[model samples]
Target: MTATKIAIVGVGKIARDQHIPSITRNGAFELSATVSRHSGVDGVENFATIEELLAGRPDVGAVALCMPPQARFDAAWTAIKAGRHVLLEKPPGATVAEVEALIAAARDEGVALFATWHSRYAASVPAAKAWLAKRQVQSARITWKEDVRRWHPGQEWIWQPGGLGVFDPGINALSILTEILPQPVRVTAAELQFPDGRDAPIAAQLQFAGASGETVSADFDWRQTGPQTWNIEIETNDGQLKLSSGGAEMTIDGKVMMQEADSEYDGIYARFAQLVAETSIDVDLAPLVHVADAFMLGRRIVVDAFEM
Candidate 1:
């Protein structure tokens, strides 16, 4: 069988670190081309813009957009119009509304569209979800704190409007939360702290209410200093369940449950390959919608200025 012809747009850090490597390692998809203003892969064809790439390379069957959330919609639209299946990196677009538009467009055009949340594919995450599904939930708390200077380095788009500062990482936790919860949860209140010089919030405290009347709290901060932490704890009738190291490991009470090494990006590529073969679309926007709601409805606070 012929491999699925795939091209990548916005060949920046994420595309290089995750998508490109996964695509190259996976057998089902062919890395046909790439579009970037300042970067290109070795030997693969390169174009200055996605429009130029689509116009010049009609054989490209799918396009993976690894751009900042603010610029994702236009690139996705262009690719869809060019009759290429589209795979969007997390937090799909500038707004949940724009993702809705993309869904409509992809359906009308009869091409697959996938909004990938890499974190949801963490090894222990599926086990946690299965465990939760069989038990009764009482309450939950998520504490995700990271050293932004170390993780982001000089990434400037993370601090801009629609860039999703802390929420960029926080959304990963939410994707897992929404997936494991037996019932749906809604944000009841949120407090966002914006850096003095930035348009986006650097940290957020979110309170959520589940359908079973369980209260959940999440604290997301990007200003953590040393010894970063990313943990989610849930109390159920059976016992306490916890996922630490960004869902790489699981535990209960004080006992080690299951330790899983990270391979979320690989899982994303595998899923995308399956979707391409089935000619199916799998785009879920609940996490993005919760983010938009937080942005639209949450109160904002000004915090210390953050550099880089």
Candidate 2:
């Protein structure tokens, strides 16, 4: 089978670190080109803008957008209209409305639209989902904290209006939560802590209610300086389920059930390949909706200024 020619827009840290490598390893995809004004992958053609890439490389049938959420809509719209399948990075768009619009456009164009939640592709996520399906959830707690300097480094867009702040990482936990739980959940309340000069919050605490009245709480903070924490503990009628190491490790009743290396991007690319082959849309807005609800219902708290 001829590999699908694909281009990656926004060759930033994520594109370089995860997307590029995943695409290279996947037999179904060919890293045809990239769109980045600053840097490009070795041996691949680079365009300064998405428009140039679209116009120059019509052979590239798919485009994976790794840009910030604020700038994602326009590129996604352009690609969908150009008859190219689109794979969006997490958060999909700056607003839920934009992603909704993209869905319509992709339908009209008959191109696959995949809003990827990489965390949902973690090794043990599927197992956790299966385990939860058989049990009744009593409660869930998400503690996701990491140092901004360590993870994001000098990225300033995260503190901007559309960057999503702590929800950037927090949404990963939410994605797993929404995926594994059998019932739907709604955000009941939230508290947002914005640094003195930043437009987005550095920390957040969110409360959610499951359809069966199960309580879920999430604590997200970017101010953590030491070892980062990304864990989700769920209590069920039978026992407790804990997913640590960003869902790469799973434990039941404090006993290790499953653990694996990080291959989330590989799984994402593999799924994208299937979507592209079938020309299907796999955009799940559940996690994004939860983040939006947190922002809308959260009480604002001004905190100390954060510096890199």
Candidate 3:
């Protein structure tokens, strides 16, 4: 079988640690070239900008944009306009409004566009979603806390304006929450706590109201110390369901139900190949929309100055 050629943009932290390894393991894709301002992988062709990459590597069938959310839409639109399928990293674009523009462009060009949610492909996520589909939900809670210094060392964009600080990690939980919930949910209340010297919040608390009359509360913080926690608990009529370690494991009332290894980025590549073959698009912006809504409508506060 022939492999679909893909170009990697940004080539930053996530692209190197996750996307590169996943692309190497997936047989359906070929790493054609890269676009990055500072660094590029050895042997592969490189360009300093997305425009240059697309112009130089005309054979690239698709481009996976691993840049920050702020720079997503223009790269996506450029690739899609050039007849190349576009793949977007999570929190797709800066504003929900820009992604809508990309969607319109993708449709008019008759090409594929994928806004990837790597967390949805987490080890136990499908199982949890299926299990919940058969049960009656009561209420849900999500807690994600981690030390920013350890997880994102030396990264500064996360604290800048239009950057997503705590929501950067918290959006993963939202992906899973939106996927497993049987009914649509709307944010009822939200509170964001920003560091004194930062433009983005370092902590957030959110409340959601579901069509099934269930309430979900989410707390995300980047100040955790020991035993960093990323857990989501759902209280249902049947029992309590818990997904911990960022959906790597699931338990029902403390009884282990299912667990598996994660190949989220690999799954993303495989799906991208399928979309390329079908000449279709799969871009789910619900999770991102919620984040934007939180930014636009949620209450905000400034706290102590955050470092690292």
lDDT of 1 by residue, 231-251 (tens): 999999999999999899999
Model 2, span 1-308: residue lDDT tens = 99999999998889989998899899999999999899998899999999999999989999999999999999999999999999999989999999999999999999999999999999999999999999999999999999988888899999999999999999999999999999988999999999999999999999999778799999999989888899999999999999999999999999999999999999999999999999999999999999999999999999989887
On a 0 to 100 scale, what is the lDDT of residue 129 in model 1?
Answer: 95
lDDT, candidate 3, 62-172, per-residue tens: 888998887787888888888888889988888888988998999899998888899898888888988889998989999999998887889898888767999999999
Worst 10 residues of 1 by lDDT: 288-297
Compare candidates 2 and 3 on TM-score and give the better one.
2
Model 2: lDDT of residue 258: 97
State in Å the error of residue 308, model 3: 1.1
TM-score of each: 0.97, 0.99, 0.97
Residue pairs with colliding backbones in model 2 are none
RMSD of 2: 0.7
Off by over 4 Å in 3: none
Output the better candidate (1/3) by lDDT. 1
Candidate 2 off by > 4 Å: none
